[model samples]
Target: MVFKCQEDSFLKQFKTTIVSCDFATLDWVADDDNRNNGETRQLRGFNVICEDTILFPEGGGQPCDYGTINGHQVRSVQRKGSTAVHFVESPGSFEEGSEVQQQLDWSRRLDHMQQHSGQHLITALFDREFKYDTTSWNLGQSVSHIQLSTPHLISRESLDLIERQANDLIREGREVSVVLVDPATALEFQDARAPRGLPKDHEGLARVVRIAGIESNMCCGTHVTNLSQLQCIKLLYAEKVKTNVHVHFVVGERALRKLGEVFQREQQLTAALKGGASQHLELVQKLQQNVKSTRKSFQLLLKDFATAEAERLEELPKAQRPKYFALHRRDGIEVDFINTLLRNAPEDILYFLTVSEGVAAGSSAKGHMVLRGDPAVVQEMGPKFLELLEGKGNGKENNFQGKINNLAKIEECTALLEAHYKPKKAATAVEPASAS
Candidate 1:
């Protein structure tokens, strides 16, 4: 059904009589693009059907219009058969046959108009120049993209050409008009592209949007009256996904906003890199190289430290050595340190070693641990050690290894290890004292 929005397209406010009001529920789902951790929710309101409305219901790849009815906020509108249903989120109900004031969010309406019209211009230019049919398109919150029915990636030069042509036509200020034609006579217009045929509920006439000297296409979304209203167009990039190529672009104010954002990001990079925009890339690459060199030197130092620690343990007299030893590192997640220490140390002493990511101990800090000793002891201590560190792992008989997350519980784990190997005194017989 043709809507009042399609008829005028620029109407901001209108007085329309309410035809019916019924209790309804709208299931609102979070859009993947702008999701803010909001789950799907049910919105309760009255479905107020109006005699006529300026608010456009969502269809043809365009989102629904947000507006108000009698100063009550209406976040959603939908088309049911041939009627427009306005979901009014008001505690009070509207009387049927009473007049109500409907207001449009002008900024939102204008943005949609510019983008929808801009898409027609882009689709027409692509089909004319490269013979690429636009299979589908999206009108996003910040940017939009059109899917072309082609497997080959669009080149940078082709993008530049299309962008330039689109802007040139925008400057030409060509008229854009919509006309209702009989469904049987839709083919009378030459070069009209209707990928998705007419809607099933559509009865009388089919609506066709025409751009002068360009092309005519069947559409149901609201649009601008002229190409000049688009201001400008910017083609961002093209990416091939599966069988189709998506060409991303922005129109009018969105183009200006995107430019401002890019420039701001460039300024931030210049300050962080201590260089101009042109030198940012080179400076960052040099910084990365320096880090790589430093990390290698650090690893070598850790290996030397591990060797020194092993030698200290080995030098201790056999009688003076403890049954078990525990070592923990908070500097980094280098399990090789544990490996090196185990390899060089005396084999008799049980070793419990850990390496974590955080410089300071934290409950949520992640790390890895290894337990090496007698086969029986390793099997017995593996589960206890993992339980203390809040991690899951299994190990071979004499060598148990696992990943851990609770670095703050390392002290508790160390105490358990020390107690397990602690000496226990033998009890003396008391039978002789009792006989005396």
Candidate 2:
């Protein structure tokens, strides 16, 4: 028995006997696996390097398949030109020439197939319908894009028209045709050309899939046999990038599910916010007013609060000032805490603020506070200052902030400043005029 396939179609099924075999399995797996966390496969399954397999590993910026085959986990799949190989996660070996049952992960493949096919149809609309050539494309897992060769601001009307035409072809159930021809004969279609990303050795014959009369391009990734194989499609997002429109799209079952999810979420949000399933705009206005009023009130409270905190922390001695840097939670204190304290202090004292890692997750922990004051008078209640707190924090410096496991440090930060630097101290200190 003999089976035949197109030169490019050989990745799917071919009965041609192997003319040669060598150790071409990628050894770079160990390096890649190590970089992606610590997942390493211990499979000893037969490493089958076939001339044909439908699996297109993540190459050319496309994601790889994630499914099982024949009960063995084919963890990695790679394709080079027309040849594809499947790396199984097992220890058993299959002879090279063995005729065995083969199957593909259809659910996963069908998704990509439709997406890839849809890209061609849409791309054709740009060229045939608008005379713009696709400059670049990225057929991602969820969305496919095309970069038009010319810069033209595509209006929403243009987008809608193209999308409508593509869907119409899919609805029509047009039979897709895959044809192979020698390179010399391939150049005969002067206007027709293969899609981007084909092997450079085009001197040999190549495989091209044509969508009925809609579109044609080179592709090794699995694609729908007919337009009907691709169900409905929805254009999710489209943004203009210089001369091109960066489109994110969805097709078939996934598109439907996504639309349903969006509508459902919208309805729920309307009900929760506006007391009905449709009063969203009214509710949004009400929310805006409430937020504005609350912000005004918060500003008043914060002004008074920060003033009181600043005044109360003005005059504490170096060792006596508890790690007050945490006062930064009040916003203004972040960079200003040290400066504010220094302003009211005698010049002999140097105010310092330090930050370190916090309890678990936070922007950062404002660690300790230290005031370099007269050493003769300085005594460290400082290290013991943080010892009384919650998490671990100690300092040879003037201040520290830990878990604040101990809240007692708060009293230390505020009291010395409040007791020593009375407001009277500031108003009364007038410097004598220097003799000129």
Candidate 3:
């Protein structure tokens, strides 16, 4: 609906009467069947229509203004036809015809204005300089982007030029004005960019925004009165998205915040790497090389130790051999180490091998397991081992490999195998009955 925000974009507070209040439920689920089956949750808010409001509803690629009405938090604002609906978060509804004070979250409102206006400035420059038409734009939480009608990516040189030109306009303090013009007379203005046509249901004069000697376009979003209010516009980067080139950017306070965040990250990296910002990449590369060398040496040591352990197990007398041979290695040892060790083992050996990410007492421990032995034995015990560890695996012949989550259950799994293969006590025959 036509409101004070349309006439004065900087209005932060106003008093308005409630025209209507209704209970509304916003369903989050996409499918009706899922909503009916309770698979979807609903957000309940009061849709309170105000007689007049300074709160701008979501439109023209700009987000709605968030604030409070009569001390109750306003979560969302939307426009339905000629009516502005305020979604107020309250357990009870506000009384119709009652006067309520409306307060706009000024910080959020100003941020939207800065970004929206910055987009207009940038769009105009691109169209004038490179003949690139803006197909779409997004005002995001941290950064905004405009999609240009170009299949090729925008180059750094072109972005820098546009950015410099836009900032030049900001520095000049160009006057930004909004005017209402009749549809028939709109074409009389020079270089005026109007929408193809007004919506069939749209009534009244069209509103057009003009920047001094720069651009004139039809827009419904709130904007600053002058270009200087935008502070500065920074084109961060650009990339090719399908058929369009999407340019990411930040404006005003958002640009400053982004700069601060980048500086903080750089400081953190410098401290961690013990190097200056310029030397970070080279230092990181050296650190990576060192890690690779260390890992290679550690792997060789594990292989040699596995080989020695396998030989020691094989040299044990058959009668003294354990029913089951299980090895639990620390985290970072690969499953291939188990394969190497089993290569030296006899076919009769039943081995349970595991590499854990953490100690058994901690729940986060996770790793892989490899079982090797007679096909009949593994076939009988493999499923049980996986079931106890809550794991899944596949096998062919005598070798089975899988990932396990509960490393604490490894000992229990091993005991099951040992008990199954343990030698049974011999039974003696009785001859006393024949003698009697």
**Candidate 2 lDDT tens digits, 88-132:** 654455556654444455566567677777777777877888788
Candidate 1 stretches with Cα past 4 Å from truth are: 24-43, 318-324, 377-394, 402-406, 422-436
lDDT of each: 0.86, 0.53, 0.81
Best by TM-score: 1
Q: Clashes in each model (backbone N, CA, C under 3 Å)?
A: 0, 18, 0
Q: How close is candidate 3 to the true structure, as a TM-score?
A: 0.83
Off by over 4 Å in 2: 1-46, 54-70, 150-153, 187-189, 195-197, 201-203, 274-277, 312-436
Give me the overall lDDT of model 1: 0.86
Using all chains and alpha carbons, the TM-scores for the candidates as numbered come to: 0.86, 0.66, 0.83
What would the TM-score be for candidate 2 when compared with the true structure? Answer: 0.66
lDDT of 3 at 421: 67
Cα displacement (Å) at residue 287, model 1: 1.7
Better of 1 and 2 by lDDT: 1
